[model samples]
Target: MQRSSYRYLVVDVFADRPGAGNPLGVVLDAADWDSMRMQAFAAWTNLSETVYFLPPTTLDASYRIRIFTPRQELPFAGHPSVGAAWVSLETGLVSDTDRLVQECAAGRLPVRVVGTGPQRMITLRAPRARPVGIEPPPQALRAVLASLPTAGLQAALWNNGPSWWLMELEDDAAVRGLAPDLAAIAALTQATAAVGLAVFGRTPAGADHDLAVRAFCPADNIPEDPVTGSVNACIAAALDAADALPGHDGRYIASQGRELGRDGRVALQVDADGEVWIGGHVQGIIDGRATW
Candidate 1:
């Protein structure tokens, strides 16, 4: 029996509150594992996604990371990238090095660690977002409205690298308390070939945040993602069209998880040049060994 040692970190991307943000499991030092083993390990953790860290085969990068969901492997995932980078930092994979690069199936992405505080912020460079072609049926709008918690809001669809259904609510409160029908959403999204749906609105009357959001993707097999970086990316593009982003700086704060009572938050920023950066703090959850 061959035994392999692995360290896993529980990280919350896009939220400061412990249980509020999107959860990810980082398995550090997973070397030479095939896709089948990786898939099994990811299903074991059962988080939104689990990132496996591998030593770089070449000197071109620092580490190799693979992201997997319980159902399948993902080419790219936002929270997993942030969580993996944080795990690398915590595990001493990268020292006082302010800059770190990780190789993934998507490609090599560079990360810039801002500060060393308890809630350390790290910004990741997203690959060039090439919008894919999707022609959703006219019923997409109606299905979206019917599945939403609020019926009074207007919904718009956008393709920011990934297909996204953007719902603009009447108020921050409306966006915050949304309860979506996952099965319905998944069916519609899959039928329309949309990646997922993003619900958003202005901050509540007494809220400190700028906007509230929630994402649903049953076709992707995700139900009520606590915090979604890809959805935020789509929001960035949508807001750019509305000229709603402050100073037109292309950077904004997106709030999520409140609907689920988790209350997670994500920082969304995009440059005029179309570069996107998403970040948040993370915490370690568990670590152990895997025998196969």
Candidate 2:
């Protein structure tokens, strides 16, 4: 079999500075590649997520993208969506449109870009998320949470595309000090069909961000994700549903991945109608081609 070369870009999503957020691989042209090839390449890259850009099947969409993790393909993912949009604009794939319509297994979604150059920001109207209900802590979940201080903590299940078990801790300290049982977490996620457990807490008063967040997904071959847009979106949706979020502000920032030495900042906004938008600044890191 003959292998083909493709243009690829590596980008950091939800970061104000380079190398401060979740890294994603974007294959700019993958029309000829099949699903197996995409998955193989994604696993080879060893990134949390990789995306392939192809021509849109629908006339309304500017382009279509497929998201893949190291293990399998995902219908949708937040950082991959944002990173794909940035790569599209940067590579002139959708130059004529300010708002990009993306087609994926999750359906068509819209992305808006603001500013330019290093200051450029991209926001995606997240897929509609709803609280599935609170999950009773099973034995596996209990094992994972045993080391963490859980007093006054609240947990719930939310679905945006991937199902997540969201936990709100008392403060940033609790969130940051977690040493989770990855084996237990993997067992729980696999048994429940959830992606993983996501924990967050309120930041110190007057801090630059409103919340501190961390995600654990050993089941997905990722021990921890640096910055996760989908999980943050679900957190917002869950908080808004319970009326627990800050009342005075519809827009806030979430700080994540600091424990891993990453400074990821995710921008979140809730519309008057209660729709959530997840966005942040994306930086292009590697401009190169891949042959496999």
Candidate 3:
């Protein structure tokens, strides 16, 4: 048997500072590797998500990416997309084009890079998301919502590529104070074939962020994702559908992973055409190669 060495980079996405956001592992040149090998490497890395970069199959795309979780492969993901784009630019794989098209299971998506150096930010246009349903079935929804206040909480299921149960609490405090039943959440996600439960609440009137978010995806082997691009994207879509997002300006910041002692800031914008763009700063953490 022969072993191959592959270049890999780890980056922190949606971070206010280095090491404060979700970490993503990227295999820079994985065109030759098969799906099983990629999955094995992703599981070994033990990151929330690991991506493989390959040459694009489409004329419009600059490159292609395959996203994998420890337990499964994903059609698309928020942080991995941002992290992959950053890696592409840093490695000189792609020029400083205004925007880069990424081919993935979700299809071709556009990614834009802004700023430079530590201030550089990468934004990805989230796939179109719509409300699939409101609240899981009565019994399931009740169990999942247990141990939490329900007076003003609103719930819905949204799907872009990954399906998530989105919940809107009364305020940031309520969202942060929640003590969820992980078992029930896992069961609910399994039953609904959802990624997990994502809860958000409005921040104070004059806070720096507009919303506070937390995502739990035990079903996917993630207890709590520090910063979730996909979930926040879904949140934006849900708010837009309800006409509850900031009307004056369609741009707002979301604070997440604070409970985990991480400062994960997600930048969000809803274009006039009603498209959601999720972005944040990505910091390179480790540069190394892997052999397996």
The lDDT for every candidate, in the order shown, is 0.71, 0.85, 0.87
In candidate 3, how many clashes are counted?
0
Clashing pairs in 1: 10-285, 14-265, 257-263
Tens digit of lDDT per residue, candidate 1, span 262-281? 77777777776767777777
lDDT of 3 at 50: 94
Predict model 2's lDDT versus the native.
0.85
lDDT of 3 by residue, 94-175 (tens): 8876688889999999888888756788999999888886443757778887766653437778998989999888789999
Candidate 3 overall Cα lDDT vs. reference? 0.87
Evaluate model 2: give its TM-score.
Answer: 0.95
Over 4 Å off, model 2: 1-3, 133-137, 151-153
- Prediction 1 TM-score vs. true: 0.86
What TM-score do all the candidates reach, one by one? 0.86, 0.95, 0.95
How many angstroms is residue 3 displaced in model 3 relative to the true structure, after the best TM-score fit?
A: 5.0
| Residue 85 in model 2: lDDT | 85
Residue-by-residue lDDT tens digits, candidate 2, 1-292: 4457778889999888898999999998788899999999999998999999988999999889999989888887899998888888878888845688889988999888888755778899888888765356577767766666654436666889888888777788889898878888899788778888898988777898899999988988999999999999898888787777753578889999999999999889888888888898889899988988
Output the better candidate (1/2) by TM-score: 2
lDDT of 1 at 10: 74
